[model samples]
Target: MIEQRDVVIIGGGHNGLTAAAYLAQAGLDVQVLERLDVLGGAAISAEAFAGVDARLSRYSYLVSLLPQRIIDDLGLSIELAPRRYSSYTPVPGGDTGLLVDNHDPMATAESFGALDAEDDVVAWAQFYEGTQHLARALFPTVTDPLLTRSEARAAVGDDRLWDALIEQPVGRTIADTFSNDLVRGVVYTDALIGTFAPNDDATLLANRCFLYHVIGGGTGDWNVPVGGMGAVSGELERAARLAGATLTTGAEVVALTTEKTVRWVDATGVEHETSAEHVLVNCSPHELARLLAAGDAGPASTADGAAAPPAEGAQVKVNLLLSRLPRLRDERVDPAAAFGGTFHINETFSQLQRAYDEAAAGQVPGVIPAEIYCHSLTDPSILGPELRASGAHTLTVFALHVPDRLLTEANNEAMRATLQRAVLDSLNSVLAEPIESLLLTDANGQPCVETKTTRDLEHVLRLPGGSIFHGDLAWPWAEDDEPLDTPARRWGVDTGMPGVLLCGSGARRGGAVSGIAGHNAAMAVLESR
Candidate 1:
């Protein structure tokens, strides 16, 4: 039997749900098919340790990309609490470290004053002011019509800002702006959040990642979700379902045709065929191309011998439910204040370069650069009352520059163990006590810490090469003369196919939890009508 709908969404990630909600609200019949039984994809929370009351956000830790407009438009019940501290980086064996207090500028200035960077306080504000200007100009247009590179540059209205952000290497921009190595690393960390680019490299990839990270709501504060990362996708799922959209999980879409015919197998091994007026894809572009190749659809168009950017994901994620917060080595800052925000370890500008170089040479760095955030400190709603009363906290560590190639099927387990130990050792280097001492034991007598490598992300989340951004994030403007006269083509929602639209991170202006791709895809469908 054949089912027909106005729109068929291939994956049920938050972006897919965002598209479904918008289209269904527009009175279009929309159906979302997800291969997994559960939704949210990487933005999910689970009890990793058996018999633990902690609901840890397994992947995709923080939130910065989701816009306020999406919440107001969708009427979502989600609440994002701002982090009191922006970041705290401890200097190993030093008396003090750098701390950027969100509420107090004097404290921030005082922190910088220690580095003899009192001038950086003013420079920091000026630097972010420039990014704020760029955000104001560009973020609003993400869901609207796409702009040409020249048009975007004109919109920016600053030649120097354009030259640094768009034209020149971000490394050059950073070196020119900041004098202190620690402060430089703090700013540069945004550039290499998911990217594997080295600090001295002259690539725009780091610039693009940096732009998206700080462009969040124009403030760039990565607010903590009340319930976890799951809350973001959960709200999106609720919005889509409430808008009269049909959501079907455990239905793997295997093939697609130019006519919008989708073939999938159900959980019960039953095959189903469905046709739609439009098909919105919520996976990577490479995956989309593979699906198209499986059917009557032709080969994906290439540019300069690249169908999609080389997909190599770096970073190792470790989730831990701690019995208590680890004591800080720095006596001035309390444990709560240190881990309340992003706690950086061994991530100096030069250290980041060393880690990248070592990872590029097929070995994890000796002293890995990683950041940790304790979720329970900001929002304890994700934990049970029993766990909360016991002072149990959740920590998510993001280790940078660990290449996926270092992890293979044969050594996946051993590599995860090694990386976990490395991450802990790096953290313990700054902490007064080893993090292992504070780990809560599960029912099976296993430590609460669970680590996920690139291999896990590929096998579990279906992220090709485990790339968090789906692929190298694209600059927010059109690259070629591929006809931006129409809304679909202009916004990069249209896949140059008859009825296919991209609504995932592969789309332009897409990365993190931003709903711009999904919103733009729906707008393309709506405007074309």
Candidate 2:
């Protein structure tokens, strides 16, 4: 039997849910299909370790780009908690580290003074002031209609600030603006979060990544959701359901047609067909191309009939359940304070650049630059009362410069182990004791540390090459002289097909947990109607 809907959304990730909620609320019949039994995509929470009651955010964590407008519009009940300490970076092999305290300016300044970087105290403030300016000018426009490059630049209003952040390579800006190597590394990490580019990358891919990180919500603060990432997605699920959007999980979409007919197989191996007036895709651009190629009536080329190679991601995610936070070698800073915010390990300015060089040369860096944060410290609700009382916590370590090209199918496991050891070795360098000492045993008497490689993510989620942002991040605005002839093009959701639109990271301005792509796609459909 063939069912019909006004709009059929593929892949019920958070973005798909956002579109479903909006369209359904507007009295359109919407249906969302998801392959997994549960939704949320990368934004999910699970009890990763057996016998561990702590629910760790398994993949993508933190909330920064999610607009408060979306939350209010969808009637979501999500709470974002703030961490007072911005970050703590130990001076490798030294007895002291730099800590940025959000609430205590005097302390943060003193930490810089300890490093003889008293000059950076003013430079750091001035640098962020510029980012805040960009954030204010650009953030409110994310969900609105597309802005041309000239329009965006004029909106920015300052040529010097625009040139520093937008026109030139981000590495040059970091090198010229900040004096201290540690401070420069801290600033540069934002550019390399999910991107695999060097500081002097001529392509300026790092600049685009840095733009999204800083312009989020006009405030540039990454907050922790109260009950882990699942709570955030759960609210979206509730919103979609309440809006009368039909959600069918465990349905794998295998084919899509130019006629807006979607084909999928249900959990029991049942093939079902559905027709829609509009088809909104919530998958990667690369995955969308693969689906079109699978369809009999679909084109053999990319979504827009342009070639789009599979995107390669460059990070390794390792989740750990520890009995307690590990002690730090820096006696000046409290362990609670250091772990509460981002914990930088072996990620100095020169170290990060050299790591990229080594990774590009076909070798994992000897010292992997990694960042760790303790979610339980900010939102204890993710942990069971017993575990909270027992002083147990969750540590999520995201290591950089481990590109997907580094691992092959035959050597994925071996390489994952190697990367894991390198990550821990970097962490252990700043710790008073080995991080393994705090590891909690699971029910099977195994240490509760799980490392996810690129290949593992490809097998689990159809993230081609395990690219978390789906592919390279796109600039938020339209280039000058670009055509906006259709609703898809104007809204930045074009999929080349006439009635299909992209609603995921592939969409312009799409990345992170932000639902801008979904919102834009829905608007495009609504406008067409």
Candidate 3:
């Protein structure tokens, strides 16, 4: 029997759930299909340590881009804890570090003075002042229909700021704004997160990535989800289910036709087909191309056209449970405070450039630019009472400039080990001692340390090329000459097809923990009706 519905969403990731919730709540006959047995895709929280009680956000950690509108509209009950400390980057081979405390401007200024970049205290403030302007003028437009490039620029109200951040390479502005290499790197890292771009890339891809990181919620502060990332997705799942969406897990969607027909196999190996008036795909564009069989559903490339380059993620994620927070080499700063916020190591501007060059040359960064943050310090609820009582802490390391091209199917295993060692050595450069020495053992008599490469993320999470944003991020606004006639184009969720729309990270405003893509897709579907 060929069942039919008003809408069918492929993939049960957080984005799919968001779309299902909105469409079903609007009274559409909505059905969602997921390949995994569980919901939450990359946003899941799980007990990473076997027989241990700490639940880690296995893939994506932290939240920034999720807007207040979605939470309020869906009535999601997720709690986000903002850190008082913004970040702390230790000077390589030095006993001092720069700590940005949100609550104490004097203290932060003093830290900058200690680094002898007393001039930057003012430059730092001015730089972020521009970002806040970008945030206020641009953030609200995300939920609304797409705006033209000229409109978005006029909204910023600063021709100089818009020209610097939007028109030019991000590295040029960073160089002009900050004289200190470390401080410039701190600002530059935002551009490189999940993207493999350089300081002077003319494509302005890094500029797009930088805007999303800072414009989130108009404040740009990345917060810790009180109960790990799963709470975010769990609440989303509940909201979707309550909204009358038919959410099915283990229903592997193998094929999607140009006619909006979805074919899937259930857990018991039963095949089923469903057709819908509209289809929402929440997977990577590459995977979408395969499902559509390169059909005339627009280009299946990542974010660009059919000629878009293959997607590749740049970073290595490591999850570790330490018996206690490791001591910092900078005795002036408390280990709690350093680990509480983003802890930077070997991520100086010079280091990052060198790392990018090395990774481009098919090698690991000799001193990998990485960041570490302890979620338990912000919220201990993810750990069991016993584990909390034992003072165990969770440390997640995100090492940058490590691209997907570094790995092959044959060398994945060997490369993972090499990547882990490089990460450990890089992290140890900032610590007083080795982090492995502080690892807690699981019940299986193994150290509680796990490293994830792009290949592993592909195998485990099904992230195409393990690209977190699914592909290169497109501008949130359309060009003045472009047509916004269709509902899909109007919302920036169009997949270049008549019926199938992108409701995942592949969308224009998609990426991070943001539901903008899913929300936009739902609005597009509603507009079409």
Local accuracy of candidate 3 as per-residue lDDT tens digits, 1-529: 9999999999889999999999999999999999999998899999998999999998888999899999999999999999989999999999899999999999999999999999999999999999999999999999999999999999999999999999999889999999999999999999999999888879999999999999998888899999999999999999999999999999988888778899999999999999999999998777787777744344443233423545899989999999998888889999988877898888888888999998899888788899987899999999999889999999999989999999999999999999999999988888898888999999999999889999898887667777898889888899999898899889988777777898989887999998889999999999999
lDDT of 2 by residue, 101-164 (tens): 9999999999999998898999899999999999999999999889999999999999999999
lDDT of every predicted structure (CA atoms): 0.85, 0.89, 0.90
Candidate 1, after superposition: displacement of residue 485 in Å? 2.8
**Candidate maximizing TM-score:** 2
Candidate 3 contains a number of clashing pairs equal to 0
Better of 1 and 2 by lDDT: 2
The regions of model 1 sitting more than 4 angstroms off are 301-310, 479-482
Task: Provide TM-scores for the models.
Answer: 0.96, 0.98, 0.98
Ordered from best to worst lDDT, the candidate numbers read: 3, 2, 1
Off by over 4 Å in 3: 294-309
- The Cα RMSD in angstroms, rounded to one decimal, for candidate 3 relative to the true structure is 1.6
Model 2 alpha-carbon miss at residue 489, Å: 1.2
Clashing residue pairs in candidate 2, if any?
A: none
